[model samples]
Target: MNKLIAWIVFLSLALGGCATKVSTSFDRQADFSRYKTFCWLQGCEFTFTGPSYMNDSAVVNNLKNAIIKEMAEKGFTYDDQSPDLLLDFHVTVENRQTNVYRFEEDRFLQLDPIDQSDVYYFLEGTLIMDIADRETGQMIWRSSASRYLELNPEMTERNLRKGIGIVLKKFPPKER
Candidate 1:
């Protein structure tokens, strides 16, 4: 019974640690209804700043596609020639390390280990999106989502999609 409880507790903590964290802030005074057309900020669709693994074309494409889809679903049209809002995004990945201590009991002797601390390393990735008025060039809305990245390409892609979706979920903030 004790062993089973220990395993359950350990599993719960491990899973919860990998969950994504998202935050959003917007200019309360800005009128969201006046925005309709959108275009990428500067000459590029998106900008990335991170290690080589996260700065590849595939990552950029995935980010762009996710954002475009979200914006389109929100009744926003993409126009480079003339737009009411300019959109920009930045991606960053950093190495992180953490020390975790777990109590381990000797299966045969039922004695706890003296030292059960372990060091774990992971890659933390963050996606930041910004929306600014074209004429004023002042940011109207912004959001960011961060999570520990998986080594697998498929899982990484899934995480990216999920993060982008959550980040933009509150865009075009309701009138206050």
Candidate 2:
């Protein structure tokens, strides 16, 4: 009996711990998938067309390098005037509120004890990236990644890279 119980407990724990840590809300791969391939262009080096409110030089440099690496890996070349896609980016940090509650039931209702917390929000500095058509100068593609923003620099950078990669996975739409 003791051995059987131990075996069951061990199996239960192992099974539970093996679960995935990824979010269960949306099939991340399928979300906004309809817009995966916005336009077909290549090797378009993006410029820092936006501003970074963080004022952290290290962070900025890190972002630039990460983006360049990612773009290069995707075989996208960068040019100033005749480039297939005009690349530009920015970084922003904003202060925002999370959850708010009221002590309505208690006598504290009169006192109005509302608690607030301070958190750093990191959005993909460039709220929008306009991928223009070299021939017509038309905005062929527009991408946006809005996030609560991570506080740690490394975390922030990682999040930015991941967000961009995920968004661009479906770029250069394939013709059916």
What lDDT score belongs to each candidate, Candidate 1 first?
0.75, 0.45
How do the residues 7-125 of candidate 1 rate in per-residue lDDT, one tens digit apiece?
55556766887777889999999889988899889863466655676677887677677777778889998887889999888777777776554455455255453465556677787
lDDT (10s digit) by residue, model 2, range 64-153 = 566655666676654444444554444444544332233333434364534622222332222444455555555555555554433443
* Root-mean-square deviation of candidate 2: 12.2
> Which ranges in model 2 have alpha carbons more than 4 Å from their true place?
1-56, 79-82, 102-126, 151-157
Per-model TM values vs. the true structure = 0.80, 0.50
Worst 10 residues of 1 by lDDT: 105-114
